[model samples]
Each structure stands twice: as structure tokens, then as C-alpha cells.
Target chain A: MNDHDVIDNLAESDDCLFCSDHIEEAALGILEAEDQERFEHHLSGCSICRAELARLDTAVQLLPFAVNQIEPDAALKLRLHERFLQERDAEPTRIPSPRKSESRIRGRKAPSRPMWTFGSVFAGFCVALAVIGLWNLLPSNESSTSMSGRNFQVYAMQSSDDQSGGHIGADPDSKDGTMMAWNLDPSEKHEIWCVDHEDNRWKVDDLVVADSGSAMQTVTFPKEISTYKQIYVMRNDGTQELSVAPNQAINGDEPAPSESTPAGD
Target chain B: MQSLAEGHPEAMDLLYDRYHRPVFSFALRMMGDRDQAEELLQEVYLRAWRRASRFTDARGSLISWLLSITHNMAIDEIRKQQRRPQKQQAEDQTELMISLRADGISMDTHAILTERRELVRKAMDQLPQPQREVLELAYFNGLTQREISELLDTPLGTIKTRMRLALRKMQESVELQSLEAT
Candidate 1:
């Protein structure tokens, strides 16, 4: 045999722990002398390997400590057990009925529209017009809160055409005085503008035209503003305008009763 | 152990009772939170319940299987928290040294070895950082060398070497302490 063959044979001891492949094939115990010797040698010289082995040994030792009899809250356990039994008993009888399944399938095929859709769409358009018209017509309101300890009322404009007058006061409780208005004409472009109640300044945030039927845009006030008084929706074409005051008419074109009157709950 | 495949609640309860504490404790030590340990324990049991039919007696004892589960769950939870365990404080190191010296011997013997434990602790403290980490991970975290490699982002061979070195140093420290006591 060649010198390389002899050296390979000498290193390939049956008892060598480092030769895990041999150990696995032989089904030898971990504590075999070959394994122990290799481990001892490695332990003294190899810090990284020694640390890993130590961690493994610690984990093995700690396994017993991890086992604990976990008694969940007795009441909770009992309740869950009772529920399980009840569900187990009821499961068979509650199988889906044939008629119910048929109805479910039919329902999925043809969904119905609610009556409010048409009215809301029309109202949405009117509100959009009122918002824009009122924007140029009304002077912006400047109402600041007092530094004293009393809470003050905040307002914004909300215009909708569903009601005959097509105008309503903005929701006072809306923490942010933001509102939305839409244009009814699908082909016409619409603009949404916000009026800062505190600063009495108006800024156009968005302008978009409706593609098919109706257009809608939401306008939000800056976070710095504590309250708002009005929102206006105007046509980019400048044909019609719509607005909602904090508690007044939808558009400044008409004098309407202050919508801010609170109702007794 | 009863056959877990029979859907017997009693068998499940027995299995849970047998393995819950060790698993919980291991998880607690690994995670350092009672709530997380409890949660992990429950998840381990629930998984065991679901996969009970797959278990076989030929591979190893039920304890080893449960331990494997606990180790995986605890490691996962620890990873999720993204926490690295700080090195033990000097006082804790001293305390551990005392415990190692006492070796669960008699109370009187423990009292005597307490001072010597401080020396052992110092010796352990002198070990290289990697060796110390491997020793702690092995003894306290119960991670296999493979798991340790993944957790520490080191190769398995490297972990094994570190463990061997740590233990050898510990053995040396122990022998020296014995000589001093003599």
C-alpha cells in the first residue's frame, strides 16, 4: 500500500468520535472512547466548538426544568370543556340545510342595490355644486377658541342634495373639519376646496372631473386648524357652485336657517 | 405512555402533565418572561396534540421529543424578541461558582464550598468570551450544537469546538480548586 493509504487508514479509526459518519453507521454510543477523546482534544483547543457543545449540554440539562404541570384557571378550563361538549353534541344536527345552500348560491350570483344609492348619488352631485358656488360667494369665517377653560364649538361645511334644499350643516363633532362634495355630471371636472376657520384662508386641495356619471372629491383641513367653517365644491368650468356652512345654507346663493341648531337627544 | 393517536383526552392530559414543567422552565430560562414561557408551553402542547399521531417510540423517549419542541419554541420566541442575553453579573457569577462547588452535596458541605465557588467563578470568568457564551448556551439554554450555530450565526463545527474548550477549562478550574481545597 502507498504511504497516503496507510495514513488514511491510521486516521480512520472505528473508535474516532470525530468520525460521526462512522459512529452513525455503527450505531455506537456517544460516550465511546474515540468520541470522548476527540471531544476532549477539541475542547482544549477550539473555543468556538467548546462553547457550542457547552450550550448543547446546558440545554439538555435544563430540559427537565422546562416541564411543568400547567393547571389553567379551573373556571376557564371547566367553561371550555362544557362548551366543547355542547358543540360536539350539536355539530351533527346543525349541518347546512339544502334550501339554505341553494339560497346562498343564488345570493352570490345576483347582488341587489339598496334604494339609497340613487338618492345619495344625486345628493352627492348637488352637494358638490353647492360647495363650489359657496366658495367664491361667502367670506371665510375667523373664529378662534378662547384660552379660558371653557370648551368651544367647531364647525365645517357639508353639502348634500338628498334633502330639498341640498344643504346641511357640517357635523360639529367631526374632530377634523373635513368634508366631501361631488359633481353630478360625469363629463365635467370638479374642484374641492377647504376654508380654514381660524385663519380665514381658502386653499384648493384637489380638482378632478367625473369620467362616466358623477364626480366626488374629499377635502381635508390642515391638522393645525382646530375648527373649520365651510367646504366648497366648484366646477372647474365655473358653471355652478355648491357649499355647506358650519350650520347654514348649502350654498351662499340662498339665505337658509343656521343648520347648527342642536337637537335634544 | 398511552397511544396519542386514539384521540383520548386523558392521554393528552397525562402527556401534558408529564412534560409541562420542564418545558416551561426551559422556556422561561431561555426567554426570561413568565408570560412568554407559559404561552410557548401552551403552543408546544397544542402542536404535540395535533401531531401526536406522527410520533414514534423508536426514535427516542417522549421526553426528548418534548424537549426538542420546547427548545424550538423558546428559540423562536427569543428570536422574535431580538434580544441578546447580557453576560452574567459578577455577583451572579460568584453565586453560580458556589453552586457548582456545592454540587448539591450536604448543607454543611455547601456552606464550606461557598467560598471556593468564588474561585471557580473567577476561573470561569477568565475563559474567553466565546467559550463562556458556549458554556452558558449549553448549560442554561439547552440548545443543541446545531441550534447554537444557527442562533449565534456560527458554524456547527465552531460551536462544538467552543463547547469542548469551555468544558476543558471548567474541568481544569475544578481540578485546581480541588487541589487548593486539599
Candidate 2:
């Protein structure tokens, strides 16, 4: 067919200028502010335009079907599942500030320790109290806390700066754990993670560093701490191992026991 | 998807198995590279998993939303590289229809969707080449009508006409197929 005949065959009404102008962009969800506002405004009372948009939307959505189907690598699914697991388990805990009365009596002795608290639980409590006291000393309002339990073993986190340190604890019986880090690079977000014996990384949370860069933050995760061979801090993209527990690797090139191994192993 | 939002890993596995091939296929066509499509596929599901809680029925169906992610990611990569895809040779229409019809040989997940896909493919095949080209550019590449006009060197008015006509034809095809089924 000639170009003129083709044009004759295909020419359509531009009478609905808003529909003609905005439908494609709107369907793609890429309309600019003025155009987007104008399009929506026009749609409020125009059934024809709305109907046209719905038709265009269905066509766009169905475009995927035109491509010949191909399966993605199986490993990709595994990776995404692992990432999702980490995200699911690492629920960020927003630390609430202590009441004003507690702040006023920073100098006063901490209330008598609970009689039942002892050993690691007692030690964790004292550390928490000391951290709270230190937080009270800082000008910043945010602080972190932990759930008290004797099953929790606290690991002292060592960073380059002596003044900056934090504690991580996990219950061997339950896969639940808490991580608190201080003296991080305040300007950048620091992500906390735990590497299992198999070297699979689980992200704990992305902690936004306060202005002090040294501000302390805490996150809780539902993971058995013993499964993880070590804990560390890294940049948002997981670059740069900023700090670590055990202060060093257990030993170079030694294959650790698998995750399914017996507890004694 | 709701189960995924509730942090059930099995939901993710099932959802992945059902949709991964289609999602990967769409990405592969847009990206023109298997490796890149695979990477985009991984990113798409990861984003979906993280954002499942935000998905609601108001946004349309799950497949549409998933394809939208595929489109956006592919377009982003295209823009980053400042490269336009080389115009592709058209697929053999007979072969396409034959393969689509033959898709029913095995019992697969989302059987209803497979039938719908076959109908959409047939409708898409009926469009004139120019009309199909404009529609694909706008749909798969996330291009505005003006951008498509510039890309194809067609007059802006002609591009709009082709797009509108193409949608009308496809919509009619879908309606006709539904009627036939009934």
C-alpha cells in the first residue's frame, strides 16, 4: 500500500487532545508534573478518555507475553531468597528515649539490680546500663536497648577507634540476636551483617549514623547467633569490613563446619 | 504476594517459579542480552520481595506490576549507557503463532495466564508493522510518544495515530477472543 493509503487507513481522532497527548506517558507512569496533573484533571469527568487509558494500560501490561519465554538461572532465585530472609529477620528497632526524670538523675545510682539477674545476663544488663549512662551524657536524643535474657552471650565489637565500640548478643537456643554499634562514620550509613560458617552473609539492618557519627544504634534479628561465625560492619553496598568480632579470622583457609552440623562440632 | 510480605519463604519460592520465566523473557527482549536479562531478573524479584507489603489490588494485577519493574530496570540500563537498541528483525509471524499454539503441550503453572498470553500474542501479530513498532517502542521501552517519534524519525502526528490505532486493534482482538471463548 502507498504511504498516503496507509495514512488514510490508520489516521485516528486527536479530538481528545489530552488522551492523545498523555495516554502513552501515563500508561508508562512517566508523565511530568504539569502533564500528569492536567491528565488526571481531564480524566475526572471524561469517561471516554478514562476508557481509552484503561485499554492502553492493558496492552502495555500484556507486552510481556510477546517475548518468548526463557527461564532465569536457578542460583538467582537462591540469592534473592537469601536476601529476602535477611530483610525479613532484620527488623530495625527504633530506640525510644528514656523519660525526662531518668535524664535529670543521671548522677544518681542506678536502681538496685534485679536479684534474679546473674552471669552473662547480669553482665549484659550492666553493659546496657553503662551504655544508657553514656547515652545520657551525649547531647543526642537517640539511644538503643536490648531484651534481657541469660541465654544471650555478649560479643565485644572492636573498631579502629578505642572510644567507639558496641556489643552484639545472641541466644544459642533461639535464633534471636541484638546488635548495637557506636563510633561509626556518622556521615555514611553503616550496615550490620553476620557471616555464617558457610560464608553466607545476612544483613542485620542499615543504621543511619547520627550527626555525631559516633552515635550508638541497635537492631534486633531472629537468627541463632551461634550459626554465624563472625559479625562485622560494612558500607551500604557491603564494601569495606569496618569492624569485626574475634578481632581476626579463626584461621586462614580452614573450612568451617556446615550449618547443619551438630552443636558440639 | 501477601504471604511473601508476611515473610514466608515458601511463598517467594512459589511466586518465583511461576513468574521468573515470563519476567526473564521480557527483560531479555528489552535488553537483547541473556546475561543482562538474568541480572535484571534477579533485581526485579529482590525488589518485589522487599516491596511486597506495599502492593495492593488498586495497582492492577501482579503480572502487570512485575512487568512494570522489568520495563523500568531495562530502560534505566539503556539510558545509563546512552545507547539505543539496534532495530531488530521482525520475528517470523507463522513461527510465533505456531510456537504459541504449541505451548499447551505441558501442564505448567498459571494455565489461565498461558491462554491469555496466546490470545495477546495473536492480537499483537495482526497489527501492521509500523503500528506494532510504535506500540512496542512505547510499551517495552517506556518511551513517551514524542520520544518514539524522534527515535523512529516519524512525524509526531503519525506516531500518535499509529499508537491509537494499534491499541484499538489489540483491544478489539482481545474482546473478540473472549467472545469466541464464550
Candidate 3:
């Protein structure tokens, strides 16, 4: 730091080097490592900087909330869900407890205390990515049991004039699923509905088709899949895309003949 | 959280559904590329899932915890990319502030979060340009205060002063906002 750097504001008194400005730097994660270590040591006795650190930490936490919310692709959700299930199957009963360390530079008052083994967590995460890459390289039959019955096709309704269609991935036993469509008109609002036997419909989600003639979003099904009779995608003017049963075959933009229709609930 | 720790998929499903937007949005903001952001998003949830048993009520709210994870990961990613010789980062503090100032605030955002976001923008808007720029340089751009000093051609003391002032003003604004709400 330059000589003039000492002129920056301190908490209440200028006697302490561990001042409010220094703590703010720590909160911002810009404090040099040696200074951060010194600041941590100083926090043991200085209540003024400690209080300042806690208060500044709250404001630091708020900044992330100010970011613009851009929804990720629907397929990413499917990938995450599959990864989660695979993680569960691999380690069925153990959730690893973090090894405690003051490794990160957040304030002492931070409750969760970001207790990650950054190197190990990051290395393990990379290994997981490699596994995902390998899974992609394998043919369908090689990984059929794990990924079977996972892809769902959302076709265009016959009355619709557009050629828009989508594919949603939903694990058979899991309630979480995501849907996405392509060739959609960017100007239109489209909603996905999960319909039951008596024609009761639950609006799973609605997405504004994106500018690239494609869109995707998470679907929050109201009930379990076996309880739903058909899923439909409808446009704003009450135009329907396609109504599909959970267990039936839906070809690309066309409704195929069902060889094994699910029993109506 | 209990079910999550006890190895329940439904619990993981619930946590992901409730908070993934904020997590995903923050990751995308930091990474900028769609694929990179999505990859970061998946890694974050996977980490949380593996460590669910460690999450306790004392660890703070789930939202804060999740955001903290995102922040740490983004920092690592940014620093990693910074070390690469082939590519230079394109977005700077000015562009970041403009994007944040844009009219893309979604109507569907949760009410409490939306309120906090608006209040933060107002607080940020009230700062002098120099202080605001310094704050973003450190907070968002991940530039060390020393680096910011070099980048802006200012004294290190002056950059420190700006960062302190910016954060102090923001804290007061947030405290006042909560008081007004109550």
C-alpha cells in the first residue's frame, strides 16, 4: 500500500491498524493474504472492527441479489438431476462433513463459514465432469439402465401452424423434470400443463420462448407422474401444442399410436 | 434439510426448486458464458448435496449459504481464467454497472429479494462515480484494491477510502430500508 493509503477512514479511532476500511477489504475479498492473516489475528481483541465487519458482511451478501436473473437452459437441470441421482447411488448413505478450516476470507460472524476444502472439492468436481464426459461418449445400450425412460418429446399440436417442438428429460422415479422447445416464435408466451384423467390440468410452468427460436424452464409438477394422464403445452391464445401421456410414445411433432397406454387414474 | 441430510431425493428436489434461480443467476452473472455458468450451477448443487448433512440451522439461511458457495466458486473460476495467457476478460466495472442498471429486473422475482435488489441499486446509485467504480472493481471484477489502484491510476489510500465509504453508505441504506419497512 502507498503511504497515503493510511489516510483511509478507520472505525472509531485511528489507533488500530485493523480498522473498518481493512475489514471492508476483507469482506470484499481483496485483502492480501498476509494482511488477511493479520486481520484475523487482530479480530481476537478488537470489538469495534469486529462489529464493523459483521455489519459490512450483511451488505456484501446483498450484492449478489442485485444481479440480473437469467434462467439457465432446461437441459442443465436434467443434467444436474441425473448427476445428483448418480451421486446418491454411488454414495448411498454418507454425506461428507467438511473439514473445518479458516481457509476463506469471510468475516468471523459469517454463520455458515464457507467451510469447503476448495482443492479437494474442486478436484472431485473435475472428476465428476470427466465421468459425465465419459457417459456421453458411451452408446445408449451401454448406459441404458441408468438413463432409460428419461427423454420425453413435446411435439407440436396438429392445429398449430408452427413447427416448434421440445424434449424434456424426467427420471421415471423422480418428481423433478425440465422442458425445452425449439423453433418457437420468440414473441409468444407458452405454458406447459400436466393433465389428469378427468381433464383437470395443473400448470407446470410457463416460459417466454427465447430470441433464438428456442426456450427452456423448470417444470414443477403438482403431483406424481403416475397420477397425471397427459401433459400439454398451450400458447397464449389458447392454442395447444400437444397432449401426451406419461407412458406413451410421442414422435417428433407428431402423436404416435400408443402400444401400451397407462391406466387412467 | 433433515430429509436432505438423510439421503432423500425429494428433499434435494425441493431445495433445488426453491433456490436454484438465485444460484443460477448469480453463477451466470459471474461466468458470462451460458455453458460455463450451467457447469458451475451443477457443481454447486452437487457440492451442496454432498454436504447437506453438514448444514445446520446455525449455518444461516439456505439462500445465504448457497450464495456464499456461488461467490467462492466464482472467485476461483475468475482467478483461474485470469492466469490463462490466451484470453483476456472483456467485461469491466463500467459494463457491469450498466448491466445491473438495465431494466431487466424480472417481475417474477421473489418479493423480498426484489425489494432488497432495488434498495441496493438505489444505494449504489447514490454514490459518487469514483467510489461506485472502486467498489465494483473490488467486489464484482475481483480486482484487488492494489490492482484497482494501478488500473485507475490512483493512490492505494484513495482506493481504500472509496471502498470503505461505498460499503458504509450501503450498510446505512439497508438499515434504513429495514427500518422503513417495519
Candidate 4:
């Protein structure tokens, strides 16, 4: 019988011991096709077996635990990744420009053929992606209006736990830099860290995103910017809100430092 | 889990890293051959990526959901490759209860898994040999109760009873362990 054709609580529901005996097998996916269909048809009509099956389902879920688990070969991971790229067509998504009125604080020209794009197309992510591309292309930190050269390396922040955002223009030759940031939760105290390869952290400055969800700050680091491996924007509690490896503009695949790292966890 | 449906690659990558071991382990156990298990693992993740939006957290945890997909695909792959349900006895029934140590999991999680495995091992030990053989034949080797009944030269009704008893005994054993711990 079709499931819809099976009436609920059939007059025979109470006497479904025969079908109820099969609930565990059915839950384990071991019933033959015809037996499975018959069991399901009966299950639709029999409330008793349905309840038994509910309990049996939990028991059956435990069956995998009965087997000793073996770790698959590590190379299988790379093979699986290749399959994902092939199966999904993994085409990099193009970012559409924000409308003229939707534009925010400053007019930074978006770059063509940006290397990395976030799977999310939220306006904030797009802005960060664009600047990451543009910053890498620019010869120096200079407005087209002035054409003055500051020779800064762009460090664009990638958002992690929250929707917090930031883009920094740092002089690769020195410790001085300018930061344009947005979408930060204002209540938390935000700190910046410049970390070196030896796992050293320098508490350079506090990047305060105002109540308006954006901030601009001219920063002077305690150490030369070139010496650090990554610059992190984090909460005072050391929970990393966003992280960026130095020179984010060169490539989009640069790994950001860890995020939302609780002290003991 | 909702993060996966957000179409965020980072979220999917994060989840894949967390659960791949269990998923690969389950597929490896089911497929019984390393190459086949690896292929099945690739297909399972590919399916998960494509169908993340259809998965609802209210139904089950992501690991169980991933395993269900793995089981379904493995079964189909077995049939497609013309492999029938296992026709022989398990080489080592003890192997079924072998060590399960998943690296990178928290100690508490590892302990829970360890305890669960211990309870099941103890439960299997408690079962009559006939009942343990029947359960093993059906579960690890993918034999249906009918197939097991025929393989063991037992009546179908008897096989059903043994299977039900075995599962009930396992649940009882787990609950008993939990109660004793308290």
C-alpha cells in the first residue's frame, strides 16, 4: 500500500508484532527491497511499531561504534579535493560593483581580475576583496588626486567569527601605516597584534571601530612591519575577530591566522 | 550546520576537516577495501557539498547525516560493481570490537567514544555465541536477516528474534554503564 493509502492507527495496529520485529533491521537498512516497502507500509498504519522503530533507530545509530575505525590514507584527502573542484566546476565568482549611491566613505578604485573572492558576496566582503586586489596593484599608498608615494604594503583583513572588517595600508619599509575598518562590534575592546615567524606577538595598537561601525587610524608599530609574519585585529580577550597575513594584495589564498581562539580552548 | 548552507567555502572546509575522519572511517568499514573506501569518501563529500542546503540540523547532527550519505552511496556502489552481500563469515569477530582512537578530538569526546566501544564490547561478550554471530553476520558483513538466516541454516523468525535481542542487549548495556558511572 502507498504510505498515504495506509490509514493511521489501523484497527490492527495493536497486533503488529510481526512488523515490529523488523523495525531494527529496517532502521539499519538491511531489509530487502520488498520487505522494506512492506514494513514501511505497515509502519504508516501501525503506531506501535513506529514508536518501537524510534527507539530502535537510536540503537541502530550506535552500530557503527561496534566496528574498529581505520584512518584512510592521507593522499585520499588530496584526491577528494581534486574531485570536489572537478565536480563543482569551482569557478571563481566575479564581484559586481556597488551602485553609485551605495558607495561608502572613500572612493578606492576596484581592481580588475581580483585573484581571491569570498563565497559570500556581502557588500563588506566585496569591498575588502576589491581593495586587496587594488592595493597589490598600486605602486604606492597615494590618492590619484595627489599621486604622492608612501610605498605601503596593503594588509586587508579577512573576517572570521563576526562580520568585522578592516583594510590596512602599511609602509613595507617602516612601521607606519593607515587603516580603514568597518562593521566592528563597538562594545568589545579591539587590539592589533603583529606576529613574527618565531610566534612572537607585539601589541602594536588598539584599532577602535567607533559606534558608526567604521574607523580610520594612522598606526605606528612597535616594530618594523616587514619583520612580522601576520597582523591580527582581535578583541581584548585575545579572541581574533579578523586576521591577515602581510601583503594580502599579492594573492587571495594567503592563510589568515587562527580565529576566535579562546584562551584554554 | 546552517553555516554550510550559507555557501561559504570556509565553513564547508572547516566542517570537512572536523568530520572527515569519522566519515572516512565509516566508509572504510563499510567498503572493506582501502581504494574503494577512498573513492567512496570522495563521492560522499562531493554529494555533501552539493546537497548541504537540503540538510536540516533539526533532523540529525552533521556527522550522522554525512554517514547516512556515505552508507547510501556505498550500498549503491557495491551493487553497481556487482558485489553481493558478503557470503562468508567475518575473519575475526574480535576485529569488530578493535580499538577506536580518533585523533584531534577532545579527551572527553574520545573518552565517550571509548566508553561506548567498551560497553558494546562487553555487550557482545554477554550475547550467546549464536546471537553474536548472527548480529555480526548482519551488521559488519551487510547481510540482511534473511540472508543471515539462510547462511546460518536457521529459521527466519529466529534470526529476527536474535537480532532484536542483540540490539536491545546493547542499549541496555550502554544504559547500565551510564548508570554505574553515576
* Segments in model 3 whose C-alpha atoms lie over 4 Å from true places: A1-16, A19-21, A44-47, A92-265, B57-59, B83-109
List the DockQ of the predictions in order: 0.06, 0.23, 0.27, 0.20
- Sorted into a CAPRI-style docking class, model 4 comes out as incorrect
Candidate 4 global CA lDDT score: 0.60
For model 2, how does the per-residue alpha-carbon lDDT over A1-265 read when each residue is reduced to its tens digit? 7322433443254435655566666765545445754565455435666766776677667767777665556687787788778855663321112222245436755333211111233355457645544444455322112222333445666554233455554433334344555434453457676666666555676666554333334455434455566677765322333455432322232223324332321
Q: Which candidate is the best by TM-score?
A: 3
TM-score of chain B of 1: 0.53
TM-score, candidate number 3? 0.53
Candidate 2 lDDT over B11-122, as tens digits, reads: 8877776677678778877876667778888778866765575576686878778888778778777767767654432432122322322322234445655876898899
* Local lDDT at B80 for model 1: 58
Report the lDDT tens digits of candidate 1 across residue range A56-143: 3432322233222232322432443344344334322111112233554354532222113334554674565455445424443422
* lDDT for each residue of candidate 3 in A96-211, tens digit (9 for 90 to 100): 11222233333444322112223333344345434444544467653354333423333222223323455444433224455545545444567777776655555677765644
Indicate the worst ten consecutive residues by lDDT in candidate 3 chain B: B84-93
TM-score of chain B of each: 0.53, 0.79, 0.79, 0.74
Candidate 2's C-alpha runs over 4 A off are A1-16, A28-34, A37-48, A89-265, B57-59, B86-110
Better of 3 and 4 by DockQ: 3
Candidate 3 positional error at B138, Å? 1.5
What does the lDDT read for residue A16 in candidate 3?
Answer: 59
lDDT of 4 by residue, A23-66 (tens): 66776677776665456545644566776666666656656655
Docking tier of model 3: it is acceptable
Interface RMSD of 4: 5.0
